[model samples]
Target: MIRPSGRTDSRLLWPIAIHPFTGTVEVVFQHLKRSPPLDDEPLRRELMTKLNEIEGVDLAEAKLDLRPSFPVEVFAEHSEEICAVPEWFAHTVALAEARRMPDGDPGTY
Candidate 1:
């Protein structure tokens, strides 16, 4: 499940992964070469604002990972990044689930 940032009509959502050891939060966003790219600066600001609103999120250590979106038809190897704090991850997932589309479907083109 993913939440809308209300930044645009784009269906993309950010999934944050926190590194406790490094004290950093990584915002994972898909970068599709065929499509118009997401504006990173504004996105960083928006996400930072929401994250900092959390009781103990540290704003200074947030990072961005703009990874390429893999083709579904083509088999590819991938691994998910891990989050350090379970409660924070749960809260983020819940927020995403709440704003997600019904029937667990991604938005249509």
Candidate 2:
């Protein structure tokens, strides 16, 4: 069983899940750890948009499905949504991450 903390933080985060074979992407927006979580669909979409733009190709927009977390005692976590990401979303994310890294970083060692 999966357990959630039911707590949130100021730093918003989302995990990008991709299908290795199908190339399908699903982003999970979770609650923060320092503060409480709110049903912030607009915030989620806004952040997602920034990431999606990296694809640089006109593709299908994300279809948000609002689903708040369940009971605290059971599963205390923010809701998640499944969206159709561009076919090149994965490559775009990789490029974006790589660009942020320096030409000489400890990870290179």
TM-score of each: 0.30, 0.35
Question: Considering only N, C-alpha and C atoms within 3 Å, which residue pairs clash in candidate 2?
Answer: 8-32, 8-33, 8-34, 8-35, 9-32, 9-33, 9-34
Top candidate on lDDT is: 1
Q: Candidate 1's residue-wise lDDT over 5-48, tens digit each?
A: 43223333334544556544454543322222224455445544
Candidate 2's residue-wise lDDT over 1-109, tens digit each? 1115332222233434444465334444443111122134554555456444543222234343322221221111212222233323334434444554467342431
Off by over 4 Å in 1: 1-13, 18-25, 29-37, 61-109
Candidate 2, residue 51: lDDT: 44
The clash numbers for all candidates, in the given order, read 0, 7
